[model samples]
Target: MVDPDRVLVPTLGRPREDEALAYALETFPDADVTLLAVVTPLDAPLSEGGVLERSEERTARARASATDLLESVADPTATERIRVETADGRPGTVIPQYASTEGVDHVVMYGHGTDTSGFVRRILGRGIAATVVERTDEPVTVLE
Candidate 1:
């Protein structure tokens, strides 16, 4: 709660991403914001832009989508700079590690959503935001 000046917003190309990104910008209008999209192993029906693609293609698409989403939702009233980044790994692991290594003070993210099923959570425990909250030292703001 140190009045975050370095904010990290992790997105998954979901609709809820608008809320998280906007909240981070509006809440910390002067903070430097980074929008990250972690590309994980694909499942059977995994698709980017309604078309299935390979891992490399998927990673590229994720980056583009993250940048586009950030651009669309960013607060025009804020004067802070915004960045977009992408990594290849599981969100629960990569997000926290990135936050630690990059000195991210605040993390604005979404809770478990339609992408993950209930049975999966029951077996695997917490989702991305919950896992990051449990693992990272940075203060996390889950905008579910």
Candidate 2:
């Protein structure tokens, strides 16, 4: 079987996001998996600290959380195959950008279903999966 060499899974701390990562690992046993989380800075300060300092702190926390999520979902024996990452920007834009820059072979993302509608969805359209599909040439696997 031809296995992907590099797989990127963009997660948003959702249950379905974890499911997508699990599916990717199971399907491509030998691939190098990266669990990525994108942190978009809020217009309003997220913390009382200085903007730059708070952003840096938040990014660090996000990286740690992403790493923990990856560890929890990945098989103990396959722990060495997975890596954790965090980027600063919108998920849709950052995911594909990371894939291209890092030479990712494939992207796996989770959909939040069609029933919900809100400002975020309006801003991002069909969400990260759709944006990544439109922006990248690499293969995309979407798990709902």
Best by lDDT: 1
What TM-score against the true fold does each predicted structure earn?
0.83, 0.83
Runs in model 1 lying further than 4 Å from the true structure: 43-52, 76-80, 114-117, 123-125
lDDT of 1 by residue, 97-144 (tens): 999999999999877553677887776666667778999898998876
Q: In model 1, state the lDDT of residue 36.
A: 89
* lDDT values, one for every candidate: 0.79, 0.77
Q: What lDDT tens digits, residue by residue, belong to model 2 across residues 1-144?
A: 357899998875555677888899999998999998777655522222335567777788778778878877887998898888888876667888999999999988886433457765675456556677889889988876
Off by over 4 Å in 2: 44-53, 113-115, 118-120
Evaluated against the true structure, the overall lDDT of model 1 is 0.79
